[model samples]
Target: MKATRQLHDLGQSLWLDNITRSLLDDGTLARYIAEDSITGLTSNPSIFDAAIGGGDAYDAGIHAKTLAGLSGEALFTELALEDLRRAADLFRPVFDATGQVDGWVSMEVSPLLAADSAGSIAAARHIHHQGRRDNLFVKIPGTPEGVPAIEEAIFLGIPINVTLLFSCAQYQAVAEAYLRGIERRLAAGLDPRVGSVASLFISRWDVAANPQLPDALRNQLGIAVGQQTYRAYRELLASKRWHKLAAAGARPQRLLWASTGVKDPSAPDTLYVSALAAPDTIDTIPEKTLHAFADHGQLHGVLADDGGDADAVLAQIAAAGVDLDALALKLQRDGAAAFVKSWQQLLQRIADKASALEKESQLP
Candidate 1:
């Protein structure tokens, strides 16, 4: 079997961390679904920025929206939603087959709202409603401000993908927000089956810490962090609180591993994919990494329910003078900033494309 199929069979979801109009137009996304066992995908400002600025594939859409008086973020939203809604339809079968646990695609809210709880909540609602797909998740960052927005969005029954989490604590915060949302639903006699996922970023830890660590510890911190968080995830699933919610018909918010693409050139291309395999978790793989893993990735057995030597490795790193707690916060903040940067670039790309297209139209 292909390695992608192997991972899927082992119960880990492999979601393509990419989306482009070309992928949908040329059937690549569909092929991944049909052959590579890619049940879902997730997109962000960076991904959309690349898709919009990379080629002429989105030019026509940009031109139309521009002519229709849509520009900047507004234009970007219509363009993104067009792709997401189509991708959501393509994954509808897997979604239905798994009872909504699998075959999900995510769309993030404007990173500009990262610090505004009210704006985040409002954007999530508007985006999800505009998306019109039950399998679509509107991504909200897990910042201090975003936490309340996440809880409110969940209580409002909008499926959420809580993004930018870096450590077990961050994951737990979002998890608690999700639980609170479900609990609120139950108290109000609402259905508790709201779908959500707490996305923990991997790889960035090593990218940030590697320069300071000894060679032996290089590239190990991310997986260790993942292991630690996985332990927390398992414990939560087995917790009395979660059990109460489950019995009351609330679906557990799944843990998704983001930033799985290896950043170190010396590291094995499939390092993250091979190291973090586990049941009931989602790994959002970059297109390049997804192909590499499918070609030659190996399963090194599933992650231990107890987190294996995660703590020991973390201790060694701490001893080496890397403050894990401080670093997690830094990474989350950095990640959010990076998204905002990409979001700005994306809007500019749209404005530029629309202008050029309009110029060409006038000549004709």
Candidate 2:
């Protein structure tokens, strides 16, 4: 069997971390679903910026929308939703087969709202409603402020992909937020099948720490953190609190591994994919990493439920003078900032494309 199929059979979901109009129009996304066992996908401002701004694929569509008076985020929303809607439909079979456990395409709410609780909640609802697909997850960052938004969205029965988590503590915060929302639903006599996945970003730890670490410690922090978080995840699933919720028809909020692409040139291309393979968790893989793994990636072993050597590895890093707690928070903050920048750039590109297309329309 292909390595992708092996991972899927072992119960780890592999979601492509990209979306482009060309992929959809050219049957590339569909082929991924059929052959690669790619049950879902994820998108952010960065992904969309690359897709729309890097080409003429969206120019005509942007022009029509602009001519109809849509502009800025509203115009971008119309374009993004169409892509997400089509992708959602392509994965609908996996959705039904997994009983809504897999096959979810995530669309992030505006990065500008990352710090706004009310705005994040409102945008999540609006985007999820616009997509009109049960499998679509509105991604909200798990920032200090975004947790409340995640809870509220869950209470309203919106499936969520909690992004920007980088540590065990951050993962737990969002996991509990998801539980609180489910508990509130149980109290209010609402169905508690609201889906959620707390996404922990993997490679950025190494990226952020590389300049400060020795060769012995390079690229190991992210894997250790992932192991540490996975231990927390297992404990939560086995906890009495989760059991009670489970009996009451609540689903366990899954742990997801994000930013799984390798950044280190000397390392294996499938570094994160091979290291973080575990059942019941989701690994959203970049397209480059996904194809590399499918072709020649071999798994040495899957992660341990008890978080093997996580504490030891972390201790080693700390002995090297790293303050992990401080760095984790910084990484999350920086990630939010990066996404906000991308969001702004994407909107500007959309406006530029729309204007250029409009002027050209007048010439003919």
TM-score of 2: 0.99
For model 2, how does the per-residue alpha-carbon lDDT over 1-364 read when each residue is reduced to its tens digit?
8999999999999999999999999999999988989999999999999999777999888998998999999899889989999999999999999989999999999999999999999999899888889999999999999999999999999999999999999999999899999999999999999989999999999999988999989999999999999999999999999999999988889899999999999988999999999999999999999899999988878899999999999999999988999999999999999999999999999988888888898995
Q: Give the C-alpha miss distance for residue 26 in model 2, angstroms.
A: 0.6
Question: Model 2 misses residue 207 by how many Å?
Answer: 0.7
Tell me which residue pairs clash in candidate 1: none
Q: Across residues 220-310, which tens digit of lDDT does each residue of candidate 1 receive? A: 9999999999999999999999999999988889999999999999999999999999999999999999889989998889999999999
For all predictions, the C-alpha RMSD in Å is 0.7, 0.7
